[model samples]
Target: MKTQKLKFTFLVFIFSFSNLFSQYTEIINSNNPGFSESPYSVGSGVYQFESSFFLKNLSTNTPTSLDNSWGVDLAFRTSFFLERLEFDAALTFQRDRLLGNFTNAYTINSGLSKIMVGAKYLIFESTYKDKSKEIRSWKRRFAFDTKRLIPSIAVFAGVNTDFVSDVYKTNTVSPRIGILLQNELSNYFNVITNFFYDFIGTNFSEYQLTITGTYNFNDRWSWFLENQTIFQQNQTNTSFAGGLAFLFNKDLQINTSARFLREAGNNGSYITLGLSYRINRHVDSYKLLDENGNEIIDTPINRYNNKRKGFFNRIFSIFKKKNKGNKTRNRGKRKRNN
Candidate 1:
């Protein structure tokens, strides 16, 4: 009986440990092929790269009548100090051809369009109850978890540099800040939202909001729909995009997306082909557990300094103490009988 009880306690402790470190997953988490970003970070010690190549066409009713552009967007992401924190850099380079409305002459321009360095730190994370553990009723197992309504939130701050081509250079370095939110509605569906203020204290400042929804068809196939809006001093721009992604393996993904844009004086569209890959070198920290499934500090000083304990550990410690008391009583009774 004691042996069986110890085995059960060990299994429970293992399950709880995995649940506590849920931020890390075996698969790579990439934010790509969409304008919005996820609040979750690539797990600590993982390096990820995402890139997209695109062609764009725009028609305006103003002086510049028609514009054709091709661009490549590149991003590098990595996490280090904490599982909830990530650092990233992004770059965009584009070539554009503009047609004059009156003269019908073409003007060509090419250069780096954007460069930014940023960091994201998760502030709040919500955990939902595991419905799969329910064995009594199917309804309970399949019911929606209300905790899904509360999103995991992260904050992002970045600096935009003036190191770009003359055509798109701001001449002034500026700051950007944003809030990212994500809700995992189910095993197959997720929604992410981002609100950003870009080019702070600059003449070309803007506010951007993006919402993206993704649905997984299976382990390897997924699709996403996104809408992004930019609010500027003079006019507002909006875009709608949809895409599909295929996971070639745990560390690589390929995707394609198309976006339609509407601005104050121009209508534009772009198609993107993207790839995401990661180098995962994450290692879990070691923990020590006692026979009754309680985490044990190896040193007396460490045990004295740590006060908080897991709920399961506290509950099992009570049973462990009670069992010891029962053993003492049994031994006393045998002595009295002798």
Candidate 2:
């Protein structure tokens, strides 16, 4: 009986712990060394930064030009007010040399190329079953959960400004919108997809699609493969990249990746090195529970003064009540016998 009671208490603790941290994680969740964004947000009160530097080379046959460039891309992300919402800003700076094929003349230019600010809100999230409650068969405990197929969905809205150098400015401000989706196939594998319409109502409008797959080798090491495609009025471009990431600690990570690009009469490639770091200040809210493992609704008067009951305290209180009832029944029996 004691063993059974202990097991029951353990299960209740697990359930309560999971509920408390549905959105927050002990480790920082970052999107780095890849172009695609994640559907999930950094938890509330988290400020994260991800940055990368890369060198790219492209040659175009139609334009008869050779481009060699290096750039740094930086993103800032944070969540506040709501756990499902996140705001982010991105900036890119690049220096490039453009060579004319006919005259063999080359010129170099450098400055900020892009600036964007955006917000993402998770619209739908799917939950999985708790397999720990199953006890009859080992096979049932280890079987796949079908509910993993339904992906979590999010929406993004942002504005792009042309506060850039003359060599790379469009002179127009436009709105960008996207849908982000993610499927958690298993404990170790995840897939993410994003669709975006960029530069709305502008001369350089385009559509983009990105698909990425990530696999975790262990707690500290992981790998990702991604493909991004861009479609414009006159041409289409596609790129494929693969990367590896290592988690140095709970709040820091480093990564490296290489990409191959293809377009109509154009080809290019780039290599990137990046890192992600975060400042975590999240605090879990307090919850009160009864002996039966049901939550006690909080009243405004006592909500601020009540403290959460610990595990041992709950167990002791339950057993103490049972003991008192047993003693009362024994006393009544003795009185009847006399």
Candidate 3:
């Protein structure tokens, strides 16, 4: 009767444990691809690769010069585990052609235009406005809940070096600081905004503001629109862009975008083809599967820490202990009978 009771109690414990853990939600990292970046971090233990190719045409007055340029921008980013800090490096390569009676018309310059490296840290992240707050205690510290109405805020700083210093005959390093804020209005809509300040060498400073919104039509298709404005001491420039992002799966995305620049001295437009990819980053949902392609019941404690055993292991341990106790009792009885 005692053995039966122990067996019954173990079964009850397993069922209750599974139910409690099944309620937790896994927060997927925000991967926004467009002209503007999202305030959210790429997530810990994750490496992201983003690359874009753009072709632009500009026409300027005074000497009446027309310029056509094509470039590639490549960036890589990585984050630490459970910490809201990310590191990134970026490079830009462009080839430019000038015409229309400029001093040196029809000249082509191709090389690296810009090189930058930066770090971003999340300062504060609000809890999900819904039931996420109530269950926050059960979740891992690393996961971010996207269902929140409140926004996530982060700050970033970087140094940009001019690669073509010889072309303009000026060598300078530009330092930049920026703040990013991101929020999800719903499962279908999200928004990110950025405020930036750039110290351009010893002579001038540039301030910029950018806002972007993304709309999801479904699991595979999404669209985004963005507007950016730059303010210098004596001039201001505004740019607008829109694009479509296609998710081949959760880890890979392809996008194409077009932008128009409105500047006093020059007006121009550019089109970009880009892709973002994540490496070796698996979702929390994958914990539901065990080794042998069998489904396993995950508990809240063991969900984040896979080194710990699941519900089945706990059940077997209980049975093994009970059997050992029974065997010891049986041996005592045999000695008494002898």
Candidate 4:
């Protein structure tokens, strides 16, 4: 009888603890589960910085007593454009820290939160002029840029090295491909669908999909909504986020938002604030200014813009010339004037 009772007790303990067995949870949540925000939409040759504190890993079903582990990400985005073609790269530095129970917390550091480089191509662009001309009103313009709907689809593929924690089972280089589909439904609103799939699979294959939207109340103020669902071959969670976006100026933006997460019978909420500077890689900022201690590239806007103009002007000149009604006369006038 004693032995049988002991075995029964052990089985009970295992059953109760099994729900707490979580493999891993996403360390980052600034954008949708699958997609990251663009530096262009945020600003131009800028650094993107995000800091977050997570109450729980939400990896499993353990109930948290209170405030817990946290994470941070610092990143940069730079781009050069030639006519309608844009070449951009995003580099991110990541750190994630995990703390055991707050009372007796022992910090366990895992693989790099994020170490990845992504290349992007802009498939569509709409100008302030086009947007303003159509919307017509400083008030409307203040509400937002009279921009064109990208009605665009862009592709991104990158290799990331995640220094997974020794505590967890995953250890590998994660390669991923993503599709960003964006459309401006109106002068004040835009919707985007982010789809991403990781080639490398954890115990469960990794898949994420998010539907996000931004509504501009004015050029400087906007409302943003995001719904992201993350699925592993074995487990899954659905998260929702909403927040306000403030454009401080033409080149800088501060995005402050809130995120709410739900997993099985567990639920939690938190706030996030992000700042970014956009980089237009037209000029040689290396010569004009010194690099930030951690920056991968150095360059400024106006010069970079001009450099891109020269390149695109060459590649797309044929189409540009055809659009110019007085091309021959303009050429002759320039020649004669010179």
Candidate 5:
């Protein structure tokens, strides 16, 4: 009787372990092509600001704790005129608030926070550069190059620090490898996708895929869908967002988006207002490195550190092209008022 009981206990343990990890099956992202559609490549300059929020529905069976978190991201990049060489920096800040009908309530000052920085370079080039202009905006003709394999790939590694409480904290340097592909199936639509995987010590690895599609019906009106999934620790949550993008002119894009998130223990959803703007920057070649690097000065876009470049590059580039057309101006018919 004793021997039979011991065997039964061992079998129960194995089954439970297998059941917990079965949700690790991978998901391939389809909307990533939309995100990678802009042409601000390695040596070019680019800037973006984004904010997102995550809300959770707490469990009912027992006393549970959950958090609603908000985060902001600031990123800059420069391409070295080489198109395949560049450097970039992305900083993120996240704060969360927790509440429940329990004795211990959670607060933003002591929840969870994180920040990260890294670099990427190009290793391969695709012939997907032949693309059409957006219906209304001439400024974004080759906004995002569409290709399935961006092979001239780069590597990135960075340090992450998280604040959980005053007395306890976790700090580690984590590395990530990323691949992006963009595709154009026809004149009316474009697709883009980006895949990234992060390893955090013994914690379960995180895999995220972002996919989006941009459909242009005319010069002023466009439609888009954004899809994302966060896979970790034997669970996967997915969300879908759809929005209408209004392109008023070259300098601005006003977009409103509705979002939804679904997972095993929680369901989340939110609506957001998104604005994307472009401030043109013209710069020289790239060769400036931050504190830590092997080839630190990687891209043309990230080197806005010099105020001199920020002021003169834009003013000079706009008129420089016109100077080349001076001969054409001289040859064209002109009636003198003399």
Candidate 6:
């Protein structure tokens, strides 16, 4: 009887918090902010950093009380050679606290949850310069509305290792792969989809699908909604998150979000805060410089070319050529006079 009341209360709690659940920064292109991953890379030689704190509360259909857990996640990604390929790494620390009625509250578990390292490669991106000519403006430029066309596609793969203890880790490595698709729906809206398969080192593999939609309020603010589904052989799980992002600047952003987990045995909600930063790469275009800081040439070979010519020797050679030309003209004139 009490279990039924608890279940009803849990439903009420989830619905009540629905509006507050949606929010996070749009800077990170991975699953941290939401379920969907962007098809675009961070560009070549660029570095991106993101850190998030998540607190989740679970309300099971028990007679007494709820379970609580929380985690801190940190992720970093960078482009090595080109904008098409980038590598990512992440670590998560989690704690679970479970308490029972008439019993003391105690820490059930605490440790490193997981570590992941992966890479993504951009396979195809549509050119949108022609389409953007009409609507391009300084405002749009600052808004980061660079999505070009339909079906920007990328492939990503990663391995996740579960930490067992300080000296030990999981013997089996779990590998995952996914395809990310992104499209610009309108001037202010974008959608991203990810289809993933995880090899759980078992006979059966897990499949996941995540879709996210984002709306740009302006250059500095955006909102997002995400839905994610995971399928296994025996059971399935679905989750939803909505969040808003505040871009402090082009390079830094902060986000707040809430997530709801819908499952039979374990129903919970997650509240998260995150921030991301982009470090721009340095690109040098000038190859040669003269004394007064004037650019002499645009290619690196200018240094070798200058080394072959001595200053006074070059001057003397020019004068010698002029003198030889005059002597030839005089000889020709004398012959004509004779």
Best by TM-score: 1
How far in Å is the alpha carbon of 126 misplaced in model 6? 2.0
Give the alpha carbon lDDT tens digit for every residue of 32-61 in model 4.
221344312222223334333323344432
Give me the displacement of residue 233 in model 3, in angstroms: 2.4
Enumerate clash totals for all models, in the order shown.
0, 0, 0, 20, 36, 7
Shift of residue 308 alpha carbon in model 6, Å: 14
* Residues 1-338 of candidate 3: C-alpha lDDT, one tens digit per residue: 87876676566556544443321213323344465676666665667888888998887653544478898989887776544678888888888786646465576777887778888888876545344445556554335554565787989899876655356323677888899888877657888889988865546688999999999898788899999999998889898999888888777888888999887668899899988777845333233433333345676656754654766776677766443343433444445554
- Lowest-lDDT window of 10 residues in candidate 5? 24-33
TM-scores, all candidates, are 0.84, 0.82, 0.67, 0.55, 0.55, 0.67
Candidate 1 global lDDT: 0.88
What is the C-alpha local distance difference test score of each model?
0.88, 0.86, 0.72, 0.52, 0.51, 0.72
Question: Residue by residue across 1-338, what tens digits does model 6's lDDT show?
Answer: 87876676555555434322111123434344775767776655567888889998887645344478788888887776664777888888887776655666443667786788888988886544334554656665445435455677899999877654443255677898899998876768888899999866755578999999999898777899999898988878789999998878767888889999975568889899988877766342222333333444655566665775767776777766443343433444445555
Stretches of candidate 2 off by over 4 Å are 1-17, 61-66, 130-135, 291-295, 298-338
Candidate 4 matches the true fold with a TM-score of 0.55
Best by lDDT: 1
| Over 4 Å off, model 5 | 1-64, 101-106, 109-112, 128-169, 200-202, 283-338
lDDT of 1 at 12: 70
| Model 2 lowest lDDT segment of ten | 321-330
Residue 169, candidate 3: C-alpha displacement in angstroms: 7.1
> For residues 1-338, could you state the per-residue lDDT of candidate 1 as single tens digits?
88987787677778767866666778877787899999888877788999999999887746674478998999999988887898999999999888876776888888999999999999999789888889999999999999999999999999999888898887899999999999999989999999999999998799999999999999999999999999999999999999999999999999999999887878899899999999988887645566666776677756654553656776677766443343433444445554
What's the ranking of the predictions by TM-score, best on top? Answer: 1, 2, 3, 6, 4, 5
Cα lDDT tens digits, model 5, 1-338, are 87866576555555444433321112111111123323224334433333333323333222333446555434454444454444455454555555545646554433334455555544433444434635666656646544533433344444454433432254445666566555555556756666777656637578878787778798767788888887898989787878776765654566666677676566666465545554435343323323231234435454654544676686786776454443533566779898
